[model samples]
Target chain A: MIQIENLQKEFTIHHLNKTLHAVRDISFTVEKGSFLGIVGKSGSGKSTILKSIYGTYIPKSGAIYYDSETLGKINLVTASPREILHLRKYEIGYVSQFLSVMPRTTALELVEQALLETGVSYEKAHEEAIDTLKHFDLDESLWNNYPNYFSGGEKLRLNIARAVVKKPRLLLLDEPTASLDNASKLKVRESIEKLKHQGTTLIGIFHDLEFMDGLCDEVFTMRKAVVNAYEA
Target chain B: MHVEQPILQIKNLSKQYGAGCSNCLQPNARLEKNFCPVCKTVFACKDVSIDLYRGEILGIVGESGSGKSTLMKSLYFDEEVTSGEGYLEDFHNGSLNIFTQSGQQKRYIRNALLGMVYQNPMLGLKMSFSSISNIAEKQIAAGSRHVGNMVNRSNELLNQVNIPLKRSKEPPKNFSGGMQQRVQIAKALSSNPPILLLDEVTTGLDLSVQASVLDLIKTIQRELQISMIVVSHDLAVIRMLADRTIVMLNGQIIEQGLTDQILEDPQHAYTQQLVYSLL
Candidate 1:
């Protein structure tokens, strides 16, 4: 479960001598095992809010209270770098819009890395990564190949598989299906639905309203740095 | 929350190439690109600090003159640090500063606890020495006296790096650029060091070769669980190998965080430029 109160985040462009308020006084709470979808246009601060909760961008003024399974309740905004790292290792899983693939790393190895970092044994990580990739519908032949040469949709599937392989308590997806085909999108949706059924908290940014309508428990429409939430 | 201690900890590590004047020695001295305009002092590495956790690759990315290589050299004891404290978990229970150790102690540490792979094969490997001898040389330095054991270990290391056993008897000068670099890596791993310092390891290789070398580094880290400090001007290489990345500018760390964070949402202007350029 996560509670974000008065989450205000701003970016200062030093060279331009201007400050951009990405998110201004947003508040929301996601209950345990619930899926929250954020729908917004470009620069609506949807990704910024996710980044704040993910501890990538430090909010100017806010508190993101996370009920960490290991460290108990802690404000992500004020958590030390060490605690944030620990949370990232064992609790949070983030799938950004674009897959940041390491060159020469096979798809299987890339997914396995997530589990390996969390202290999973090599054999177990490898096996789980394979299973996750299979569940995501990635072809077996492509598992040993580098993702650099893969199509955009394949890369996105690989990214999702890597993040969800370890079954993190909190999973943040930033436009994960933005470039996928309808069939690929369906595969992603099924995988996400499976994760949610397993009690994983989900907060995602989606442009496809129909895809989100079927999955999200509530949809929060973000416009011009403001959010309005309603049940789906 | 419980925190894991860094396997290698560096504090205020500074390596100066010239003597400093009073003006340049000030804590707040504004240097012209890591150089003192008034004192003519080249501060190759200025008050650099780093913490390398076990089983992680820490990347140092900077331009050619950003002192990343100097930091690696200092850590490997190839270059003397002007001032700093370096503690290794395997060395005296991390209580002693390695920078202040005696020459013999430093040699012992370098031979047993640390391994270095230089960008230039000529610098890291002997042209006349056979590949097996080059690797065996490191094991021998680490106090392995049995020739039979050294040969077996050297052969195993060469195999790990993908060098053919038949070619292991050939000198490095007879090998290709990529092959020579693989030999250097094999030599570095001969002692089974807990920490590996790689200075521009894949800088000059072909793109395909670079990928293979990077892949080898990743696999080695996973299998050996060695903490590594990988220095390069190439952000792509850093992205591929580093778990955490430190962006250095003018001998100072401008930004550092998880490699994914740095790639996706770089905060500093210099880092933004670097990431955008990669795009």
Candidate 2:
């Protein structure tokens, strides 16, 4: 299970002369295998919650628990350089909304890099990457081509393949289906469900209401940077 | 609703080149319907002709590479249309053939009359400026600024979207994705242009934000009485707001009808997949 308690994030804007509370005392949880949807208007601090959980954003006050493993201790918060590498190398996979693939990189090479970072064997990484590519149903012939030539949907799926190939236990997808067509989105949704069945926990910031209502096992609604309520 | 008086009109709309096209399984050009030697294949949006009515929200729904963006670009693009004519009926009422427009005409259309909103708010806004300044710049550029009007309007827009007014003076870069979007809208409305072209306006928002933004757009359209043409891959947003829908695949409008008919009982195979894939 995943649990968060009383998280707060404040940004001091010098030019604006104000302390903006991006997130305030927000908390929510996802039971194992539960697909959780976090939904809110822009600036709702939904992204802050994800960042805090992933250790990207340090909250002023809070506790995060991943199945009784205390995730909020100062030691855990101030992870060593090696430990930071380990955090990214294991446990979690992230796919962001903006297409952030490296410039001039081939789709294959992108996934390959993710594998390399995780310390997987080179030949084994190639095999695993191929399997993940086929799993997402991306065109096999285009694997060798630069992502510069890809469609929006194709690029996003490629990013997903890269993230999921390592098979991280927890996956965080921000705006996963934003520009996807209905057909492509349906396929991606299927892959996400398959991940849950494989014991992957998911936390996504989504805007597609029907997808959230149908795909999510539960939903959390946020207002003023906090999860106001949880619905099943 | 007489079809004679168009709020916005697209005549022989086409955007072509040595092909600055983005690669996809589909194409993104609006050509003269199905006649292209390139790709040894079809043009993206072939000679598309459509009329948007005042106070009506028309949606352009297409898969990636279907030339929806290209079509949109041809309309409100900073660049004038390569070939074709678009007549605006309400504000800046001009018979712009686009093909034969002077540099002044192109600049005029880019600055005024045509208000364009993109998917990424941060990418759209000027990061150096406060939200208030962003709107003010748009007003000054469009030559339509009100003294203290921007501050009042910016705060109102922030409140409308449920953001605190205290954040109104902050650089939009500091706002959340949703708040930045509101800033974009505030800027879009700064000049009070009668026609708004939204290209995936809610693209990066979370689900609740999506619903709220879609609703916000719907509400804005009604309150402002501005004609809107929204292009999106999300059929739900189109269904919720658009009076009319056009379903495009491979630069072709396979189906066009009332939003309810298209959503509930679509005619095209592609349209069926679009609606069914919603779940």
Candidate 3:
């Protein structure tokens, strides 16, 4: 479970001499294992809200409390970098619009490495990585290849694979299904549904309303840099 | 509907260790892998074959000593292959066998058309050199001499990996595990090769850092549409990034299929065990 209270995230454009209010006193609560989808027009702070939750940008005021099972309730807004890294590692996972990978490493190694760092044994990591990559429809032949050559949909699958390989308690997805074909989207939906069924809380920004409606238990429509929650 | 041609084709590729003795060569002789029970030999890879299309991500999943790494090493010319043929469609109408090329020709093909990323960063990066220099090194080797062009390209690649311009001057030794990996990625992309080969890239980073690096790879692939061959023991990584997957056991491809089909309806007992363990 997560509780966001009066979250205010402002960005100062030093050259422009202007302060942009990306998130304005937004408050929301996502229940355990619930799916919360945020949608709105462009630049509506939909992604900003997710970044705030994921700890990319610190908020000016308000507290983001994560009711963690391993570590008791910790305020994300004020958590130390190491604590945040730990949470990002073991508890929270994020899938953003971009895919960035090491130059020389293969997709399988990338995800396997993620599982290994989480303390999964070498053998288990490989097994789980293979299964996870298959779930997203990534071919076995490409697992050993570098990511520089994958298509748009293939890369998205890889990103999702890396995020959910360990099955974190909280998963934050920012437009994960963007640029995917219908078949690819269906594959991604199946995996997300599986995660939901397994009681993992999901928070996502979905430009596709239909996809959002299908997956989210609750929806937040962001407008004018604020979030308004509504039953889906 | 447009049918796609295979960008790279691997046919009946076999890599054997030690000399094949007369007993081992006998049609009825039963040999223990590369080593004949009657003689001494080792088979790293046996009659392996696959095809890679343009803009496709192919995955190879296997256990340790399954010859998965051997197959990759053979493809990249890191290891000597005993037999079989490999061809790139773009080169000489797919008539040239990559394996038979001379050392100079192989080096040119590797630098100009193929990209290989190893499991360890030490193999891919110069830890003591600045990040920009590391990327520049590859370009320089590829015959680019203009510093201005190289700097711009390096900066663009670094920016894509979320490395700031200010940090470009710093050596990868000073960077975090994830950052160093990103530097390696930028260096790999510096050449802009048609096909990229990666081996066990993210095995050491934390989950969060791994996600960032994976995300970076995703962005590059989507934006550039380069073909890739990824090797890892982990199925989860294969699931996310591969379009087609091959299962390898004991130097042979046991099962090959679409990633979803392999996961949801595994036919082979080994694949079933691999899938079942994930749950």
Model 2 spans > 4 angstroms off: A1-232, B1-4, B19-42, B91-94, B145-147
lDDT per residue (tens digit) for residues A1-232 in model 2: 6677777777544334567788887766678777889898999988777766665555567676664222332232334322333455577777876555433457887787678655677798898888888888889898999877889889888888888888777788888789888877887888888898899889998899988767788888898776788788
Candidate 2 lDDT score at position B241 = 72
lDDT of 3 at A97: 73
Separate DockQ for every predicted complex:
0.43, 0.01, 0.02
lDDT of 1 by residue, B156-224 (tens): 998999999999999999998899999999999899899999999998899988988998998899878
Which candidate ranks first by DockQ, i.e. highest? 1
Q: Tens digits of per-residue lDDT for model 3 on B1-279?
A: 134468999998988777878886666557665457655777778889998877768889888888988998898898989899999986788889989999988887777788777777788889899999999998987778999999999999999889999999999889988888888888888888888888877777787786676667655675577888988887777877876789988788998766655775455677767877773
Weakest 10 consecutive residues, lDDT, candidate 1 chain B?
B258-267
Candidate 1 per-residue C-alpha lDDT over A1-232 given as tens digits, one digit per residue, 9 for 90 to 100: 9999999988766556678999998988999999999998999999999998887887889899999999999999998656777898899999987887657778998999889978888899999998999998899999999888889899999999989898999999999998999999998999889989999999999989999977899888898998855555
RMSD of each: 2.2, 24.1, 21.2
For model 3, residues A1-232, the per-residue Cα lDDT tens digits are 9999999988654345567888898888999999998889899898878877776666778999999776689898887544565677688999987787655679998899778767678899999999999988899899999988999889999999999899989999999999888888888788889999999999998888888766889888888897765655
By lDDT rank, best first, the candidates go 1, 3, 2
Descending-DockQ candidate ranking: 1, 3, 2
Candidate 2: tens digits of C-alpha lDDT, residues B1-279: 112467787786765544433332244544344444444344556567778876678988977878788787777654445466777775356455654667677666656777788887765699768887887777777765576866676667667666677776789778778777877887887677888889898887898777667767866775677888999998877866776788887655677766655675455667767877886
